[model samples]
Target: MAYRVQGVVVREKDAPATIETVIVPDPGPGEAVVDIITSGVCHTDLHYQQGGISDDFPFLLGHEATGRVSAVGEGVTEIAVGDRVILNWRAVCGQCRACAKGQPQYCFNTHNATQKMTLEDGTELSAALGIGAFIEKTLVAAGQCTKIDEESDAAAVGLLGCGVMAGIGAAINTGEVKRGESVAVIGCGGVGTAAIAGAQLAGATTIIAVDIDDAKLEQAKRFGATHTVNSKNEDPVAAIQALTGGFGADVVIDAVGRPETYKQAFYARDLAGRVVLVGVPTPEMQLELPLLDVFGRGGSLKSSWYGDCLPSRDFAMLIDQYKLGRLDLDGFVTERVGLGDVEASFAKMGDGTVLRSVVEL
Candidate 1:
């Protein structure tokens, strides 16, 4: 049977997200219905409201979520009802060339539920990041659910579904920050701080956090940054170099996703060091750099899609780490709000006042 639930939805560009009656149909083949416990208010959700992601109006927003399996449809076998899980956008299609090559993190063709959630009038709603989790219940591809330890807090680990995972994966998976290496993350937002924490876990000896906001830089310290650079007061690239004894960091991640920050990441790394871009940029933006600088920088320049993570592997491992007190997933949840507060929470995100405003369902 289809379920009726209230969800946050943006009807048009520049419109405020309002709670709407969403129709979540019973899962079809290869789909599952989840009773969401909590969902985080991520920047991506805001992007959907602003139409920065697509022209698909009537976007069912919210993606970072954790929930319990409530129902499964035909042919779904990997997960069962009552299992705790984190939702992931990238449900890899194993037959895709990227997945067939064992690089499923870069799966060229990801999957979502074939069925659509609709408005009361039968208007189709595009699920944000293909999950559309800001509701009491959501339908998703069976593969999109990754079971995790039930003991974990739904509000905390739910963040692993998106921004947080991207940040951590940028450092640990993409940059491959090794023990005792110097690491710098530009943009001390939720994603950037996760990169710092990831670097710390990977044993980065000197973790430098650069951001325009001093408060965010301070918050980065709790995430294991050894030094903070207020870019508004100093040149971040220069500060990063100075902190690393004028040699530059071994890995520099651009989490701000602007041309300026990308250039900073490009120049802030040591020779042969890695630069990982995890920040989402608008299509109107363009980047130009001297060809000589590209050649002079003899290391990898990579973009992180959901932190290039394999959810089945990374989510459970990170959840265990959180349970073991090694990873601070709890630190990411700044405030807990009900679903109705999503718009107000979105406003707080602009000032970097909260790491996350989670909607606890």
Candidate 2:
């Protein structure tokens, strides 16, 4: 059977996200249907609206989500009805080379449902990151549903579905921040601030937050940033150095995808420190730096895709931390909103006042 549900969709390039009647079909083989409990309005959803991600019009927005398994398709065994889960885009194919190498996090062939959700007119809607959840219920590859703690706050832990996971994974997974290390994160947006929280969770002694917004810098402090640098007034690299005993931080994460911010992250780390880029850049953005500097830097340069996270492992662990009050996942939730407020939340994103505007069903 099929169900008609209201979902947020962008019908044209540069169009506003709107509520539409989405037709969610019954789960096909290897697919499942989820009844969304909460979903986060992420910048990726905005990108979908503005055509930054793809030209697929009538794109179903919202990927960061937690929900329950309402129905399962044939061949599904890992999850059953009523199971609470965090939705993940990467449904790793275990036979992929990356998975065979014991690094399934880099799975080359991630899975998405072959069946498409559509409008009443039968126009297929592209699911953002293949896990659109702004609607009441959504269809996805069964593997995309990572079973999570039933008691976890859907509004908080569901963020692991995207941006929050990226940030925390940038520091802990990709950057591998160690205890007593000095860490600096550039771009104190949700992801950047989450990087600070990751560093703190990993026991970094000093965590520096950098951004142009002073208020955001203040917000970073609550996430365990020991020093805040308003890059608007001073050279961020210099400020980071000053905060780290005149040297540089052991790990520097670039959460802003712009080339300028990447350069700052490159120069703001110690000679042998790691540089991790967790930001999502546009196609037109380009980077040019001295090859000699790259060679002389003597440190690793890495890009974090989904924070290099393995949802099967990371999500449950992070949720455990959130439950233990070690990770402030709740703090990341700036406001709770409904599906109608998603488009408005996009406007609030630029103002730096909100970290995440979660849509609770």
Candidate 3:
């Protein structure tokens, strides 16, 4: 039987999202139906609405979600009905080259539900990140559901489905931060602050947070930053170097994804150290650097896609840390608003008034 539920939809580019009734088909082969409990209002959703992602009009706008498996289709055996899970965008195809090579994080072929959900008028909806979850129920490939502890707050743990996971994985997976190391994170937004928390979890002795906004810098400290640098008033590169004993940090992560921030991250790392770019850069942006400086840096320059995360492994592990009270997942939830307030939450996101304004379903 088909299910009808209200979902947030962006009908046209730059148009405000509207709440409309969507029809969710019963689970098809290898698919599962999830009763979504909560979803996070992320920048990606806003980007999708603005046509920044693609021309897939009538797009379903949320992906970071936690839910319970209400039903499963034929051939689905991993997750049973009533299982608590977090929905993930990356559903690795084990046969893909990346997965076959034992690096499923870069799975060459990811999967989504074969079936499509449509409007009451029968218009197909392009789900954001292949997991449209800003509704009462959503359908996705069984692999997209990562089961975690049910005791944890869904609003908090669901964030691991997207941005928070990206930030944490940028440090622990892509950056490979180590104990006793000195680390610096550029941009104190949600991702950067999560990187700071990841560094602390990895036991980094000196964790420096850099940002133009003093308020965000303070939030970064609450997320485990040992030092803060207001980039607008000071030179971030020099400040990071000074904080690391006149030598640059061992690892520097650029979370803002701008050319200037990338340059700062490049020059703010110690010789033979690593620079990780976890920020999503705009298509028109370009970087220019001297070849001599590139050679002189003598370290790795890497880009992290979705924080190079392996959902099945990283999600559960991080949830365990949260349950142990080691990770401050709750701190990331600055506000909880209903589905109707998602547009307003986007405004707050632009103003930097909240770390994350989650949409409680």
RMSD of each: 0.7, 0.8, 0.8
lDDT at residue 199 of model 2 (Cα atoms): 97
Stretches off by above 4 angstroms in model 1 are none
Candidate order by decreasing lDDT: 1, 2, 3
lDDT of each: 0.94, 0.93, 0.93
What TM-score fits each model? 0.99, 0.99, 0.99
**Mind giving the per-residue lDDT tens digits that candidate 1 earns over 1-361?**
8899999999999899999999999999999999999999999999989889999999999999999999999999999999999999989899999988999999999999999999999999999999999999999999999998767799999999998899999999999999999999999999999999999989999999999888898899999999999888999888999998898999999999999999999999999989999999999999999999899879999998899999999998888888989889999999999989999998999877999999999
lDDT of 2: 0.93
Compute the lDDT for candidate 3.
0.93
